[model samples]
Target chain A: MAYSNKARDFFSNELKNINTAGTFKEERYIESPQGANINVEFPVGAKPKEVLNFCANNYLGLSSHPEVIEAAHQGLNERGYGMSSVRFICGTQDIHKELETKLTKFLGTEDTILFPSCMDANAGVFDVVLDKEDAMISDRLVHASIVDGMRLCKAQLYNYKHSNMDHLEEKLKETQNLRLRMIITDGVFSMDGDIAKLDEICDLAEKYDAMVMVDDSHATGFMGKNGRGTHEHCGVIGRIDIITTTLGKALGGASGGCVSGRKEIVDLCRQRARPYLFSNTMPPVIVAAANKVIDLISKTTDRRDKLEKNTKYFRDKMTAAGFDIREGVHPIVPIMLYNAKLAQDMARDLYEEGIYVIGFSFPVVPKGQARIRVQVSAAHEKEHLDKAIAAFTKIGAKYQILGKKKDEIIAQYGY
Target chain B: MSDDLKKLIIDYVKKEYLDDDSEEIDESTQLISSGIVDSFSMVALKTFLEKKFQISIPDEKATTEAFDSVNNMINLLKEFNVA
Candidate 1:
């Protein structure tokens, strides 16, 4: 009749074990709207401290943009609030349709279908397209959502090495026996901040007759010359088969995702994808605001341009400071601190110095690859970037890891 | 375990997942519990092993525990040999 102590004991022991292992996750609460700088209440109950944020996916700094907020309010006033039903059952508003159409044009895809989140889009996409006779070959370093999505389908699943085009080709060749071969990858590998060679991937897909899918969640808002995601950046527009991306990142930094690609695949998703069919439509305000975001970005690339400039500034300053960083033009800059405990400790120390960043270890990344992933936003001005860079330099020095080799850092920190 | 086969897996795991400074790996290394390879990534390794050895490791024998180390993976491969 009551919850059992036996089950409670198992969880309690597990928690204790995690604590002993120094991997217990502690969440830092943000007390203000997401932007370049925000108030974070760290260590749970401490007074909120304003810190220069460098860990948000607010790439284009539209999370709290005045125009986007005004758009949201205008939609709230005009379109009212929640959509109580699913899309097929009276939840389809004109604004929703408008956003999808605009997104199609913006993403260079023929059609688009909205989902509550990219996770839901991924979770529901695979099963609609693949069956037991087909096969799915994915990049091994793809997002966890893609991994979960692949599990839902009955297709033979294979993972090629991360970003190894030759290995992807090998998997493609191996899976050629199947009825259909689908290649899945992230447009930008989130952890590494590396861009996928979509140009090469598209060539492989063409040679092998495999369909290609890209989840451009990280690079959707501002990646190319025109800020049109990785397809445009890689010169492979109209070559990809299915693209699943998130509005939750740079596109207003709000919520909503979509499956945008050729008309037939999207048509299939609308008819069948479980998440879209069963779940209620996104709120009218989000839909309207997202439409405004698309219109703004379409009109000009100012915000994405600012973001690109900011990313270059931070990466250049940090690299010049002698920190071990993955060299890339992308905004996600990882400062490598090889030991797990060292990553956590450095993040805590950085928080003390008025910078908000998170340490990633183990499951979030791979083992022994602990890092402090700093995400630069268009919201960050010169002062904010300078402050964060200064804090990281101080913390890097305190840890004596500045310009140190990976072996030296591990020797001192001990993973 | 065959030294060459063990080296192949160690090399693959190191290059794919672990950093250059990852602690010394050997036949006794705990790949799963130590967080070097998660279950999903292990699936990639399974594909790699199957491709290299040209043997189909049954789903039941492909548990994370069975693929946790070079020794364990070697043991699992041994089952295919006997069969």
Candidate 2:
């Protein structure tokens, strides 16, 4: 059968254009599972093996943790491999309930619902809760998943400037007559690593009678005293109405997510969210492993302590080397490179120095604000961090970007 | 071209995609190719168009080519008696 021109055009010209733009990213396959340092096989022409792994979501050195692996193995033996159904269907295992219950206790919430991935947790949220009479006011710099979820709902949407409480309050006032109002923000923004103003957002939520939701994907496993999330970092854990976070980032670096909050809201999400209703339940092994992760995280503070120290060490050293770094309390450290080509070039050179980092550019972030987002981890020792810093300083001098700042540019413009 | 319909489409696109005002969107611009329309945007547009035009865009016509450019989208809407 002949395909439609639409399909032909999509597969031919448009797809070709997108791929040709140097933006079509292909994943580098890792022979081993994710960890602090992983070995990835390169393409035919390039070197066979590249060392140094600075690009991963495994913040606590727990992706390959021995206990987590054993727990996963035990679950596989007990519960089998796959669930083959959604959570409401024949997929709710004992481990799933255990994980959900533990998550509720860990987050200090009324209840929790698990999704197969954090992306789905984000994509499924708004459709379930927000109606035509509702409003969702969000931050300008929240994750892509939150934005996607908000689009799926019938709620009136407004975006305030990032972390700007005044704009958020104004939006809250504008939408006060709506049946429901929610102010959504990221606990720790992934790109720039900036922490959100959750305390202020919660105060405004109380003042305006609006509910607050925080996507704590980046903050969940390491931010608070017990790694509860950004709300814990801000000392307002129970004040926020809803918390959506990923198990994928720091909670063992596996793939899972949960929405924890008031039981009514979670129950509604379970009933209506399309991704949740349609997607298969998480596998038994993954669930068991994640359950153990929740258990481990609640009991220990070692990983969080290590990550905090590494972050401070790297941030301090990078600043001393005269690099303009984005200010934040998270492991996501953005080293700003204003030009797109410069960012790409710097990433390439960094890799040549046996350090792995990715360049963030336009479409992913605002234009003229591209950077190398170096993620610190509990796995990184002092030697690893110092070596990475030396590599950065060397490349910075080579690229003539060592001492350039916004002030320097303004002075050059004679402003 | 009724101003209301044009404004409705534009408003839907602007709000749903979280588009900034500086990104020069025009009727001839391709929403998908220009990165204004991703998977979730596609889902939202599908739902919105179904309600607005009172006709369903068949699965065959739901590819990026049909919804890419605003002109192309308008043409598809014409099939559903939009204009």
Candidate 3:
């Protein structure tokens, strides 16, 4: 296609700015399956090398599990490939209904409705239910999907401080003149592995007569005692009004998500949610594998237990090594580098040492809080953790990110 | 008082939006266009300015013209005679 000079110049300048800003995102190709150790080829033409992956969302490491693969294979043989239609049409299958039932039972919700992805699930929710008369009080640090969803809705929107119940209450009070109010937050914030104070949020919701919604994408498969979610972990299992989560993260790392909640909400989503009504149904193989993953996690707590132990081991060793690690039990551990260049350099050096991790800087996270986000999975063994920690310590010492108080580093960097 | 308000907002932005000494942000620098402060940060900043300055920013005055830069924020405050 030919472009006008004006459009071409505009896009070219934008690309140049992105490149000059040191924020241009580049994708690396993985030659092997998703796991703790995978073969990656960087620089496009380079040979693939085995690197210990610590950046995937595969918390339970079921992304390439043998049983999950086998189940997908069986599903393909039994149910065929794609649905090629939306759920309300001819796409509805027994397996699809079965998976929804399993998710509802697992989440302790009255009903569930699946979507192509959690992004779609989030995008479809707000506009359908809430109108101009309603108000949405959202955590400032909620996922981008939630922000986009709020934008699509006509409801009066207000963002409170991240996970601040007092700010939430203030917003609720400010919007009290509205007909209906809903509070939205992430169950576990992806950037920081901090779990939301759902119990407090639920209490505030009750006090203000508002409904609570949580996007538990980061805490679905192995968060609570039974891996129910943050609501279960925070002792507000039945208190939450709506829960949106993904099968793409922990539940076998396939591609599907669901909004599970009261029957009316699910029914409304099924009827009016644009994504569900427009997008094709999830492939049968993925649904089957996700169903199997839920069954596996429900039957045994082994994966979640291993993940917990690995997180503790890595967190303790890194902290003991004088590396400033964020205090959290979740696997998403941030080794603070404060300086964006330092973070990028450390991640590059770690990759050279055969450990794969990504550095997050401004826009993705708040500015001046740059860090290498290390995601530990149940798939990582003790040796893998040891190797990653050693690489981190070595990189840390080289970059002078260790052997000093976090405050000292921040002050030195003027961050 | 306007200078003090600008200083306060600059310090807050420096603490919250800056990570290193690479980028120079002045009073006239665009906060939203330059990606220093996003929608979320805008909300927080609005709350902070309202509480600290003891002035209510009406819904119509909450756009980029009023809050895009330290200078603009100070101008808005001065217009309200709060600074």
Candidate 4:
């Protein structure tokens, strides 16, 4: 009774507005495990349909791998199901320590500290390391989790243009008066799928006496030559002051994250990061599975190489199909459909055609930049890619959008 | 600032943000305050202004109030000596 109808009415009206905007998100039920192929049921009551998943974050296709399953099983056996307490409590296990050591080696960082998720890592990092006297300069397109973390901190926050190094340098130059300046960016922007210019960021950081942080969640498992991450890809591995990433994506598609960087910074994270201190520690099963994943990627580049090849092939064919695919070498290929309703309609149509991809609209992306973000995975073979490309072409033709530009598409479907 | 400069700014906003080419805004219309352009678009517009005018409008000077309208934008540019 204390929770009034006024509050209820507010949320109801807000949801109605969202529905009217054609941007209301609905979750599809998935019966199977996460992978390139999943059994999905849309709008809740419909029978589940077997669909080729083109929307998952399973970049390396290891989410449902037999070896990964076995490792997870082994882990569940060796170290029970869950950690009932936080890390500083009785939750820290031997496997957790082992995984940290392996991650440190794999990442080429001096130290590493684990969190329940990368969101937790981002949430806990800033307030622990920075205060009002410091300044945090973020790329305009950095992940939302980093933005939320910044909101919780008292530091002066500024944003440079997306991937614009000159703007970043200018911000850094002007912020030299602050006690510390931290330049933060995502390794690969999730929407645009463009790689960050980390080498230039590092040079600017050095010139301005600033620290650098990269939330390399999207690029952690298969970015560089050895898959160390964007730092390795950009040839600035040991120079990054803080490297935050996740195990929830390509690493094993389980849930865990870490803040890995300078030994002292990680030490401070362990001692002070609120999420690590307050939330329950990462489960031991994920630690054991992540250990196997790190070991596998460390020994072989087969999966990542396959992923890269598959991505390039898919991108080339999609471009040839005349879809307005965002130009990127990353697997997060956003097919730009400027209208929200068009994006949703295309996604629904593609789902009916047995391809599962989600449409992203405003506020997930900027207004008028709505699209269907197709995530290409290594599990998909040439047949899958060909079928997906054919499906897209057919759908594009149906919508009369195959050969259209942004303005043309917008004219057909309002932005 | 010259009337030509204000027209140029208004034209850029119409082309980029209001691409429908139907809705109109004069020199005194609210841009940022009325949600015609958000912070992200403001940065993009700031980038355009900087490149077009060859002036560095520092982040602090490019406030919401400064970018709220074509008139305010012109005033901020006037401080930068962009006529």
Ranking by TM-score: 1, 3, 4, 2
Across residues A1-415, which tens digit of lDDT does each residue of candidate 1 receive? Answer: 6669998899999999998876787788889999988998876898999988888999999989999999999999999899799999999999999999999999999999999999999999999999999988888789989999999988888877778887788788878888988999999999989999999999999999999999999999799988989999999999999999999999987888999998999999999999999999999999999999999999999988998999899999998998989889999999999787889889989988988888998868877789999999999999999999999999899889998878888888876
lDDT of each: 0.90, 0.82, 0.88, 0.89
lDDT of 4 by residue, A269-344 (tens): 9899999999998887788889999988999999999999999999999998889988988999999998888998
Tell me the lDDT of model 1 at A228. Answer: 89
Candidate 1 reaches a DockQ of 0.44
Better of 1 and 2 by TM-score: 1
Distance (Å) between predicted and true CA of A176, model 1? Answer: 1.7
- Write the residue-wise lDDT of candidate 3 on A113-172 in tens digits: 999999999999998789999988888789999988887888877777677777778788
- State model 4's lDDT: 0.89
Candidate ordering by DockQ (highest first)? 1, 3, 2, 4
lDDT tens digits, residue span B25-83, model 1: 99889999877777887877898888877888889889989988888988888877821
**Which residues of candidate 1, in runs, are more than 4 Å off?**
B1-26, B34-36, B44-61, B74-83
How far off is residue A8 in model 3, in Å?
A: 2.6
lDDT of 2 by residue, A80-187 (tens): 999889989899998899999999999989999998887898898887888889988888778888987887787876777678787788788878888999899998
DockQ of each: 0.44, 0.10, 0.21, 0.09
TM-score of chain A of each: 0.97, 0.95, 0.98, 0.97
